[model samples]
Target: MQSPGIPRSREAAPAGWRETADAAIEGGDDPVPSMLTALLRRPATAFSMLAVAVLLGHAAAALLIAQLPRASFGVEAIEDGMIRVTGDDRRYAADAPVAFVGSDGRVRLARVMEDLVPELEPRGSSSEITAIYAERDRIAALLREPGLMLRLPDGRQLPAAVRPGRIETLSSGFWLSFGIALCSSLAGLWALVLRPREWAARMFMLSGLGLALGAITIGALEQVSLATGSRTLFWITHINYLSAYIFGFAIVALFARYPRPLIGKALLAGFAAAQGAIWVMGLLKLDVDMLGIQIFVVLLLALLAVVLAGVQGWLSRYDPALRASFLLIWISLLLSMGLFSIVSLIPQLMGSPDIVPESVSAAAFLLFYLALAVAIARYRLFDLGSWAVNVGLSALVLIAVLAVDLALVLITGGTWTVSLAFLTAAILWLPLRELVLRRAERRRDKRDLLLLRGASEVAFAPRPEQQTVLWSQLLDRQFSPLTIAPVTCDTAAIRADGRILAIPSPLGGTGLVLSYANQGRRLFNSEDRSVATALVALVAEMVDARAAYDRGARAERQRIARDLHDDVGARLMTTLHRGDLETVHADVREAMADMRLIIDGMSDQPRRLSDIVADLRHETVNRLVLARIHAHWPITAIFDDERLVDALQARVLLSVTRELVSNVIRHAGAGTVSIRCALTGNSLLLAVRDDGRGFDVDSDTILGNGLRNTRKRLEELGGSMAVQSGPGGSVIEIGLPLPSREQGMSDRSMAV
Candidate 1:
């Protein structure tokens, strides 16, 4: 069954009823108007409509009062509680009776009819004869001319002529109170209409309604007292108490549910029973003292409930939103209570008149409700840590400001002390607050960075199992989930519990899961989710990179095996079969040199251009001397300024140079060879000229394997090679682009 103030859609109903309703609406029935009519029939909606009507009625009354004529009157003191007034003198008569107008705009006769009393002396009174003669002489002079005599209730005589003006100040206060009640009612209606399903929201609505009803009762009773000069209304006064009790109950209940409920069912039941008992006693007018005792007991219980709520909020460490909301509620309630005590309760307790108007208390209550409403509606439920921190710091600064003001007032006196205190506080407070906040933020940021760094380290772990272990450790340090285990479930669905995060395992599996139970009793927030996402992405990238590295290593080993089998293996076999020691030795040396080149090329270290040039010159000269050929390798500085080349580029350049020199000595039958290296623009230029019989150009001839490989290497390095051949001489020129300036400088620094 749906509650009167709750929506039907929120309550569970018979199967298919909602579906039928939806289908009927969708099939061109135009049920919106009907639906609205049904809504109006609900008790909650009817109550809200009534409240709106009441608000409009009060507004109209205020407008009517504004249209009334203005009246002014002069007041003069004649005696205690007596005044003489004269206005537009033509309106008053000498013998006419006069009246005074009250603040409710009602006028009553100021004169009282009573019998005159003759002065009598007590039998035991000591009367001096000279004093009695003087009093008799004064009385005889006043009796010379007899005029119309009148007496007031207090035995004081009224003035002969007087006038009264309209009184509206108290009327204005009543109207203001009515307006506050109207606003409270409307706010309650809004909360119920928007979120009637939530228990906390319902409690808030009830509190607002109670406050509105109480305000209305108090305002109306006070208004009647002002108009009729009677302040006692037994029935209506009890009704006011009932409304107050209801309001207090709802407020306590709301605190119990908000953030989290701390009180058990038994305590809640006890609270309800106490409130009911207090209400019954107040209604029956039985044992007034008992009623007071019941009220005090309920108050104490309510305070305990609020304290328990704060404790619960603190215990739920991960729910920053709840903690923040509770803190705001605590601050607002204490402030309101303090103001009420100072301005109203304390004065009344001390038998003094109220120093502040009742409207101050009304305003404080409104502020408390408004703050809670904002916190619930606007702040995210689990992600208010930063906001909570800021509010706490701001409160501290405010306290500091107040303390400074008080200290200055004590030391400097009232004469300009307030201004000086404010100035000093502004100068000192802002910088200190900024410094503390910055430091706090820096610490938080550092912690976040550590989480990221830990994840990155896990990404680079050598083994997949090791990565999982490290990832689990990172999660433990950060979130501290209750358990970590593999699950064959959907990895994309991330779930969380109080201080626990359920994330997909980095290792590939449908059911692999890593559950983290956090150390603090807090829930995983959006920030934790973001960090986890980044970690997963990094791990995926690192896994891909590792796979690529392994594949490349395998392919390189195959290429090395093929080169050794096809070149060195064949040459050594031929030399061994021919029984030629010199040929075998030469083949072994060439194989060793080839193996060294391959090893150097596979290394990650870079080589400088000058170093490569020197190595190339030395190797070419030694090869020529061993081959008994005149070599004119006049290669000098390759660059005017020193430059660094990466391993791949350097290997390609050296291989091509060495291959050209070897071809000249072994195949070309050249008597002499000249090598030159230089830089032109951003390109490195190498020229190898040989005085040997050159092959014919544009002929269909298969090039040697070494030449083919050299050409392929130059193409891969984004460079081109040109060959100019003739019977007299042949030249091979290679041009390669240099690295960018910044990269060259970085490499040079590293090399140095």
Candidate 2:
């Protein structure tokens, strides 16, 4: 089962699963506590190890920087090419270029510019820094010398010697940069661990790796006072620019295909080639904008791509869960990418000071990674479709557009060219957003109608077994859970943070468990639970109504069958044994009369209890006389004689009394029989007393078929029959329930 906080795995193929897809009540374990996190390994070993390795990599970067000669010029670049040398121990000239004489007799003139410290100074530029690149090889070879002659602005020349830098010498800024980079890498690995096959996750991880590489390499160069090596400096600059372009490419590719696929892998490859070429041009120093304008433009496209992706994802509401997942992805991408571009790239483009440190700006990428991690953990987990869409994601995107446009104009002298791009969106995007929401609402209504139709199919299925089948089918079609297992839950519930859902039968039986909603593409939420609850309730009501109808029909048929065996069958059997022709003829007539009563009893019409009792008394007396035994029943002794009884109850009452008389004649051989009737509580009480030779009533006495049939008739009316026998006589007691009469009926009943 797909559980929350874990990636969903492939569903195990159940035997004959295609026949029904998912079967209810087949016991299946909940897959909440998952072990298959990544590449068949646990998080501790796979993803955590990546973080540990990045930790070690940070130490290695620090160690490499420590190996560079510590110049300690005591002159820090305060701003664009401006140096501030404080205190007498400072070695560099305050207002003039410092000259260095290497062991190879090369005395190079120093010309300081913002290009030399573009990364260190907030407003530094690399425009004038190109000269050092051509001479980097010779200077790198000379740094190996033991000492060099230094000319300071103070006109004092001293021999400069190198001391090996310690770990303590590394600035806090360097640590912060590596730390941010490490965090970004870990975030990507975390997402990849959860969903290794997802392109969105893979691209997000790729972006993190790019961000990490760029941050660390730029940090190492910015920290270095003297060159590390001829090749090393070249490699560091190349890695920095390459990482920037890679980060941009990954972000753009991620936006193009995530939340919904706008482009395929082939187009993604094209994006890679384009971005890679831009990085190549930057490395070759082909133009003035190579390092700054071209790369920053790519970043701008990446941001625009994500915004457009988010817009497209929101508008295409076909997959509710996917749209929901895209909500987080879009908002986070907008805020993180938007903020970083504004504070870092725009300033560099506009020749303005950085608003925040580069490392801190890089920390904004962490939010992007965090959003991806959260989107991975949460998406493929369905939330309420419209709720996910309407949670201000579109507004945030629109706001980001305006904010970026405004920031660009405000930072870069407020140009109309930049402002024009966002002008149309700022005006029309909100209405377009509302239109999409309206479409989503219409779809939701249609979804509800479909559920109603499905419920009818489930509730009115001709057979109980078929009803169950249809029920399972209905749920499977609605939610499309990968696994629907058996659960002992009685009420509708969502478990494992919407990973598993329990849907109870309205008839109050064990329910089915649904895991990994949308075929494990999403988790279950309250919206799902509410949908399940509402649908099941409709099905349960119809099911209960149909069941009650079938139960009544079945019970009536059984009642008719029982009455036939006890009344008509018993009378005809008794007459066949009788040798006298007149007695046989009289018995056959009585049987026909009883059959008419049974037929009349099928109607819902009520009869007077007083008249039913009088007829019953007369029939019992005649039977006793026919058997040559005295019978007694007082006409007025029956109390509550005005009460009415339904036709079924009246029919049961007469047939049961007659069966008692038959048992006495055929088995008791009684001389005197007396009948009594009354109402007690909600029941009608009847007793037959016979004065005869007593028979065993308590010692496992077996009743004749006639007597057994009498008890069965009583049971059909929800009544009971009990026998008490002693030396004097045998007494048979019967109690049949008196259902409440229909409201507003007159309290009048006619006697016979």
Candidate 3:
């Protein structure tokens, strides 16, 4: 139906259109800057810029990490004013209140928290006021020294060494954070570059950018604090909060206006303005309470608002496609945001240990950005078909295998870890693969059956228009589109963000447009488009077959009409005017014989050429004898095993023989008539010669009805007739094409 990944606004092109549309922006194209316009025009350029920005962000995080001192000392916050040391390469006193003294003789306090910040005690609690901004800056400055002097409770000072390397010193948590940020930003950038001016796309890009910046700040801060026991920098913590607030608001804004606008832009603007104002106030310490549980509560509220906005969006839309797109975004928001919250944010607010590391959970945000890009663009724009499922499953298996290998390395440190991981994954995947394939097979079978039944109904339709009607019905039954109408589209495409599906006609005109699929419950997705495309191709073949059938039917009717007029009518007329009973009986009998031959030919029952020749010769000789004319007909036994002919071909041959003999009997006035039949090459050749006072070949033969009908019948079967009529005699050499055995059988099957 369309290409995979994020597509441009308006779904697809019709005639003259840009891939990236800017009409949706405020003041239309006027508000879009020239530089942004140029970037949009060249997606590669936009991608390069975005990639550079992401790389720079990562580089800053990496550089900062390399600068930080590595204590390699695990710190767990036990309670206020104290900490407990866990696993470390260098053992310290088990119960020691250790303080790090930097080489600069500056002392730093170590406190561990999930976000690399000393947890701000609640205002009403015994802990009271949080650490002042000056104190936080002092702790941050002390941690900046290259290495630190470890001071334990026992008064034993240990010189902890530190090192620096851009990539080598980077921690695992940092990489996870980097991945989450990179993936999130790129997904959003795809949509933004494609549809920069589109509101939905803008909000989507904002959401991704926010997640990326937040992930980088949080990951860098947490990893640095975790490695070197130190308090989280105040500014970095504020940066994380800023990114989080922006991300939350952007999601809320996105859902508010996408699919169906749930709220006005003014309301969305107010939400954004409030976050900005509150963030500035918190940064200046004017609203200390707003920076603590208040921020989490605000984020939670924002998520809930997003859910509500999605619900309203769904309720407000009647178009199934649009609703479906909204639904995907909504569900993705809930799953990705929901998982990130439950495992990270929600737990932090609840004062419970996190279910998973925040860095690992942050990656969930990637799903939302990707989902938003596709849903807003047009959900299911691409039909990767079962291949999408295959790819997902393969990736899952690979991750599982990797996880197993890592686990094996940690648990047993075995050299066969890779082999064991692959073996385990293979064991699990083989059955899973069979199960998936079998399910797919079942679904495909049903679709194939539907196609077969539909094609038959269409191809065998009594009228051309009926075929069109049946074709429409088939599509309607398959997709259950709420609205279906004719549209002028040479090629099938999904348009209006899947509100309209254009399917090209099989009969070479514009096809029907289907909308509101599943009766307003879903959009016209790629699967629907694929089904429609396949049906169109199937119908094209069926239409061609129908046309061929109609042609054959018309030709058959004309052949039957000509046969009735030429042979039977002429015999019946002669029978009516006869005076003698014997002559009249003979005329009726000959007419009945002609009718029998015509019926046999029309019935598609092939007869042996030798038997037909013998029968015709018998009839011709009997007629000649009655007319007092000598008959000398020789049957060539050499041609009995010759090729067979179908009913129509047989009919033509019979008619030719009858017309020639009738001419000799009525007007030839010959003393002797000889008929010779031979099978030459792929033709059955026949010669009827009469030694009678023959008419002029150029004049009388042209006007003779009997000869004319015989020649016409022969020509109809792709046979030929040569009349060498003179004062001596007239000989008609007729050559009708003889069919091969296989072809004759096939033609017989299709004769009707």
Candidate 4:
């Protein structure tokens, strides 16, 4: 049941759970039921259910409003303690007490009826009124005229100040409250659905529930007050206060838990109990003054909670994403509450009518919910620190743009402010912001590059112990871990402390364990893990490569030892047994020279053809002189001195030359030997001719060990050797192709 591409190992899920996880991963089973089960298991499910209930309640309220009978009567005119109204009498009763408007254009409660006596006349001639009246005597005194207009309870206008549209007002308030409640509930449900395990998310769900309840109660209170024409709606007020208490408690809880909880469980529980007590008091309709004091206490506690949360967040070293999310939440809370506070304070300060209504203030809570939702859903939750900075910069730019636009508008008295603001932002602010952001990004990139370079050094480290030390240093620099030690774990994983990361050892045996970050800093993030994974992979490759190289080197050394024992050892033994002291000495000297050449060949330095030719000529002449033979050395360098040859080619060429000279001296009884070196086109040619008794080229006996090894070496170097043997002389010709400049560089790099 394991998924394709996912490895099956002991590190994977346990036996019972593995199959289900694999099925889900492999897309072979329905995962929704399991997911739903998981969601329902969390405490947030209760809040989610509450949200759904709130939504359904709103729907029911809407349906009830639709089924109700419509109001009919409207105010027409006022005259001599009497009011004239117009509407369909069949639908409306004659004596029904309805909402009315007097001369001053204010709504009031009054009885609308058909006149019993027909002598009453309209009084007022002016459309404007001096004042509103609640009593009949005052209303009659003011309504000695009939030119004033009024709106009816059903939202119809009349000539006189008559019945105000109470029904219409109630309908508007109900729908607005219902919409706010529905949205708040949905936001709560969404937070719970997204991250049920998060305590902050649970608190947010409760906050949304509180907001919905508060909106509903407040809206209902407004509707009932309008319908009954009474301000003493004590029961509705109590419910409203209860909802407010719940809302304040939830908001404080959410703030305390957000990003990460700093408050203790006992303290949180105590706070919750106090809020619950306040709610109970409101439910019991306690003394108004006592209720007010409790409500103020709840508000103060919420404010205190917010302040503590802010302090904790500011002091803590959060990862980038958490920092950004916290900043966003802070901004959302501030804007929502700040705007509402401003709206409330402005009217009192200036003694003017309220510019923003209560209904609009209720909708501002949505901002905080929306911000929480975004933070939860985002992929890089801990890396949004840069985003917070950008948000601040953008806000500043916007404010500046607005200020400039206003200034220009006021100065020119024209509609050029918008265009000017756009130009200013495009030409100045945007580019500046981009430059600053790019610089910040470059700093981050530089830090990453430093880690990469350190990893590279570890990869090419000369020893396993050095590699381990370097790797530890790299982790220390990148993550500031407190300690790094070898562990027995075979798989990469996060440790129990949450700050430690365990990476399986690349060198095999004990794995590596990185402890907590230094100074009790923030926990290790995904980005740090990703970088560590890359380092581990690189080190693994290096270890594998080094192992393969050691294996190949051991095999090569064994082959060389076997060859030396079989060929050179036998020759020296035979010479020693025959009591040929001079030949024995010569053989030992040649063996020592060959060993030196082998050592030289192992070096990575590049050799030039001219230098190699000179060394070969010297060795050849010395050997010929030792054999008491005349030597003719006519060598002409046809290639440039800078033309480099690799170690392999130098080794092959030297080996072949030594073999040819030894053959001419020890086997061929040559009196004189001639050597010629020249360059032909892109090839280097070397010919050695000796005036000695030549062997037959076609004879099988003529192919000795020396001749075979010479031919093999030439062939390995991408060259060819030809032997021409006769009675007069024997000639050996070898040709090797020269590599181009680019090829030489490539070969040189490969040698390194």
Candidate 5:
């Protein structure tokens, strides 16, 4: 696709250009006045001026084109010695047709071919023609045939067809005047009565655009039919008319984007979908007709009714922004349609009936653009200010183009001459405009700098002692965003012992500050109040985190204490009962010592109960040896209880703590180790919560034995222990409640 001498891709821009753009956006001082405010005041005036210029230019060009000689088209006939014309731009005259021999030695009917065909066709392509040439009375007979034809040199007949080319001349001045009137009416209505807003303006413009295009196309088609006898242009014109009908709905749908009702949204979506479908069908060569136009019109009218109803409902609710938006939109609709209707009448009055001209569409659009610009500049309609700016700039650029076009037309002698003139005019005008804008900008800059200097001078000026109160009052007045809570400031002053005044915050807290002049000076100079507010929020978050952590820590400690008392104390009491008075005393002392050790060890420790079970399993192996039970410990323990794990881990350990000691004094005759630890849901179980001399667990003495003590301890910790004792060594199981992950709380319910 690249030209032979051109590169496929241009090289990347140097970094300097990017930096300059950034600087422009950020470095501009007082951007509000520089951009937005300036635009709001001057843009409307500029638009109006440009519109006038374009109107003048187009009018001049049209007048010039009109002055050229008119051309004739289609067939001319002689019936009963009277001349009758039946094609486009028909003119009747009595004349005898004669074939003329050209210098090229070809015979031709020069007047009809040159004057008739070119005039009728007029470079307009989408036109149809169905003309016949015969004696006036015979013409009616030829018209009766379905396909009108022309006789060729070979005696063959061909169907009559005219292909109009690019541009067409306006055959009637009245029609042109009618178009001008319609446009003028719309513009006048827009200027005087319509609210200074956007939606109204846009709708007015779009409808005009659609109708104008429709009219132009229709006129071109008529031009073709006048040249060639065919119904093609007529059919194409009808299709265009249908499309224009949809364009009206498109304008209506735009207003639906405003926070409208459900019905409005549905209408908007449905209308858009229909338009899309129509476009797709058109692209696929599906021929739309007058019937299709009727169907779409009915649908659009229904949608419009629904939208208007919704708008009424919204108005009843009384939202000012919505009211403003809807009002503007409706105004646009009325202004455009009302003006269009009036202008459309002119053609009928002038005996050259057709659709309104394209210029009317532009005029309507200008109004719509103005209304929308008002919304963008003030109300931020659709939150689309950026898009509006771009579109506005484009319109301005279009004005410059029109200006260039004017210069080019003035210098027109040939294509090259016109092109050169256009380029030269643009180059000259652009620089001049830029220079004027820069000068205006400099003046604005000077004004802004002077104002800023004044503000800075007032800000930095020296003041007396009395002014400090006035200064604080002023700062408070201007900076209402900082609504500081009242706090007491204690100033240490005029006290022999140097006592500072304590200022209490109104809500709860207090602050102390010296009342010394130096302190006051520093306070006036400081601008770190924002930093203080941020620090307050941060500290609040940290306090919440700490409170949560402390609650968890407290719960953990309580559970551990309960476990130690139940497990270890019971075993120690048993030991004291079995010994003599002195020995019993010694045993008691030893138990007290062990209790102190467990409590001291746990003070700083935050281990979970499951981990303690694993440690207890290994410790129970040594206890078996110490107890001299000389029996198989066969310990397999699992701790899954939340409360019981923390509550009974120490108790479990204490029960096993001196099992080997007791066995040495009583039943354990052997001592190797076999133990395993695991955890499962809902229960913390110790297999060797006991392994000792074989005895009937149900016996009265054994029922109240150390085993009973262990069982009671287990029950207290929300656990149950069972002793399987007979002749072989015993196996004990302590089942305790497990922690619920949810609830995040230990269940201290007694073990069953």
Candidate 6:
């Protein structure tokens, strides 16, 4: 059993095997690079391709229009095509209408009655000029309103039907219109694709229906301008215009109920019934040419309904997502419809002959469609409706007040004083508003103080002084200077360092355990919980001060122990072992006396070298007398810290001084010795010169006993010793780092 079983060799196993397996099992060690790679893999969308196609189509159309002949008239009608004029509450007509021949002598018609062609006259272009044609009934009816005159290529004002040359240019306008409409349609399609779900399925379907209606409207406006010959196309244009108006109203109603299924279904049913009624009227030939007023009324009702429903839903505690949807939908509905109504009505009211009513309406609707798309794709308006209302009301009030004040001053005839006063009042609104808001907030906060009284709670336990007990459990919460939480609970007795008290709370209640220390005293308070907080700060200060004190004390003790071991203790021990009673008695007494003095000085404040130089000199002289050697020591660089300089850093200086005096007595047999101390740069230099029987400087046989040990002690003091011995005498020089006493006393130290 004693013979150990052959020990298993640990080196037989492979190295780093566990580490390799760990690395293999771990995945996704580098996260940032992998995320960047995933982002780079995302694909582009279809809208990019559609944009390219629209741009190319525009470029081709522009090229085609540039090649068309300039100022080429495209419409000519005369004679039987009678022109009727209606203006200033009356209609005018020309009987026995005669066709006006052109410069090339072509006569198109002769009429029994001409409505307004007699009002036109030609200059410098001659023709037979007399012809007749019967008036077309429908053309006469539509041309009945000639409130405005037209200018021809020859700069002549004429009736609507009687033109000396071609009256319309379709080539350039058609090419331009094609480019604009194509690009607009492409953009609209892209918008339609962009997250249309939020607008209720019915809204998206209505948008589709609006697009078809818009195309028909464009065709109707084009037909009226071109004066095409087809009767069917003429009447069909009017019906399409009515459809466009009705569909526009339906789109608004559907968008108002966006994201709600039941509202959308109800709206769709209403829209269908309205459309059927309008179609029936059109079929019966009621001639409904303008439906803008009817559509406007419908939209106004829908907006009012949306606002009321939104307020009711908010009061009923609807989900946050649904509430936000309703808010943004209402905002878009109000703003877009309001802008469209105002802008579209402007052209009709101004009666601008060049501006197209349908085109302006379409542009406004385009912007609305884009806004709707954004609202559906992004749940954008957390506060959009409120923000709009607040901003709008503020602007309106400020403008009205300022306008009234300015107008009153102006009407009363003003100087700069009145103008300046109104301007200052308007400019001061922002800061005045801010001040008022802050005051109101402060008042509200004060009123609710009772409710907030128990809102903050503080936890209490032992502070950091007792590491054996955990820190105050409530201290886990951060401390704020202005607000405090006070918590109170009984804690378990302190444990050893790092030991935790797992105190459980009762039933559903929460409780805390704290770190504690007992030095025959209780450290916590029964009242204010801040006692623990103050205790923590006090303990921290004590810890730093105690650490510094212990460090200095340890260093001083080690120095004293080393001195006794190498000096007095060694000397006494040497004398006792020699079997000389007289020498042993004297040496032991000296050692005991020196030990007592050292013990007494240990509690005293440190002293400087200059203060203790006289004592050192007397002790050195007595020792030298015992050794039968003469000695002299003169301190030249006197300092205020005598004990620090002579007792601490002067250890090397004193040792060198003693060794030099002893060697002169033992080996050199010198009669006299001189020791001098001085400062050089950051160092302390000492010179020990002696007159004795000196030996060869370089001879190995001349090496003295204990010389190596003396030189080593000098070097340990961060100094070097040089010895020169010849036939005449020997000199020993020692240099040391400046003492700490010297450092503290320096004038530059005050700046630190």
Considering every candidate listed, which one attains the maximal TM-score?
A: 3
**All-Cα superposition RMSD per candidate:** 13.4, 13.9, 9.3, 13.5, 24.4, 19.1
TM-score between model 4 and native: 0.49
List the candidate 3 regions with Cα displacement exceeding 4 Å: 1-163, 166-177, 193-200, 218-238, 253-304, 307-311, 314-325, 350-353, 377-495, 498-551, 575-585, 700-703, 741-752
Query: What value of lDDT does candidate 2 attain over all alpha carbons?
Result: 0.67
The residue-by-residue lDDT of candidate 3 on 1-752, one tens digit each, is 33233234353321121334233222434535654554455656766787898778777766775675554444554333244444433333334455677777766665322223344322322123344434444554554556766665666665544433356767788888888888887878777666666777788788888888888886666555433432445466677878888788887777677646778999878877877887776555553565455457455756765677568655857655455555555556655665566556765666654556677777655655575567664435432223234434544565577568768866985543779999988898899889988998999899889888987898788887897888889888887877778888876777766656788888676578877667766556677777788888888887787789889899878877777777888888887888989778777777888888767767777676666676777888898888788988875663466455556776777778888888787778899988888777767788889999888777864547887777776675577999887789888898877766555432433222
- For candidate 5, what is the lDDT? 0.42
The parts of candidate 6 lying over 4 Å away from their true place are 1-44, 49-101, 104-253, 263-270, 273-318, 346-369, 379-752
- The 10-residue segment with the lowest total lDDT in model 3: 12-21
Clash total of candidate 5: 45
Q: How accurate is candidate 1 locally (lDDT)?
A: 0.56
Write one digit per residue (lDDT tens) for candidate 5, span 1-752.
12232222211111223333345555457866457434433434434654676466545544543343222324443332233334434334443332223234454232322223222211111111222121211322333334445433223333433333333455453354336434533443233222233343444444444444444444344344343332343344455545456555644554444344334556666776776566455334333332343434534543573466346536633432334344444444444443443344233333332233444443544455455434422233322223334444444454445446545645763222436545765787689778978998998698556534433333333443332333233323322222222334432111101111122221124432222112221111121233223323433344455557778689657655654554356656567567466546545654664576466556543346656655555554544444443434343434553433333345444454344234333454433323333446755444542333566767887554455655665666666766666655655555656565553445444433
For the record, the alpha-carbon RMSD of candidate 5 to the native fold, in angstroms, is: 24.4
The CA lDDT of each predicted structure is: 0.56, 0.67, 0.67, 0.60, 0.42, 0.45
Give the CA lDDT, 0 to 100, for residue 437 in model 1. Answer: 79
Report how far residue 740 has shifted in candidate 4, in Å: 3.3
Ranking by lDDT: 2, 3, 4, 1, 6, 5
Q: Which 10 consecutive positions of candidate 2 have the poorest summed lDDT?
A: 12-21
Query: Candidate 2 has what TM-score?
Result: 0.49
- Model 1: per-residue Cα lDDT over 1-752, one tens digit each: 11133223322221233344345445444678568545543546655676778678666644543332222222222222234442322322223344433334344234311101111110111234224333433332322323312233333333322112133543555666676677776776555554545556677778777777666655544343111211123444556666666777776777676656655657766877777877776545442443344335445544654565566556754553345456565655544444444555454444443444565466655655565554443223234344444544554554455457657756865422456666887898779878987998999899878976886777778877888788778767766655556555433333422123346666565323334324434435557666667666666677777778888799678656655554456546655775657646665676677667778877847777778788877877877777777877664556334677787677677777877776676567788888888888767888999888886645546355666667776886677788888888789999877675466732223221
TM-score of each: 0.55, 0.49, 0.66, 0.49, 0.30, 0.37
Q: How many residue pairs clash in each candidate?
A: 12, 7, 1, 17, 45, 20
What tens-digit string does per-residue lDDT give for candidate 4 at 166-218? 34445676678778878887877666655555676677777777777777765
Error of 2 at 347 (Å): 4.6
The candidate with the higher lDDT, 3 or 5, is 3
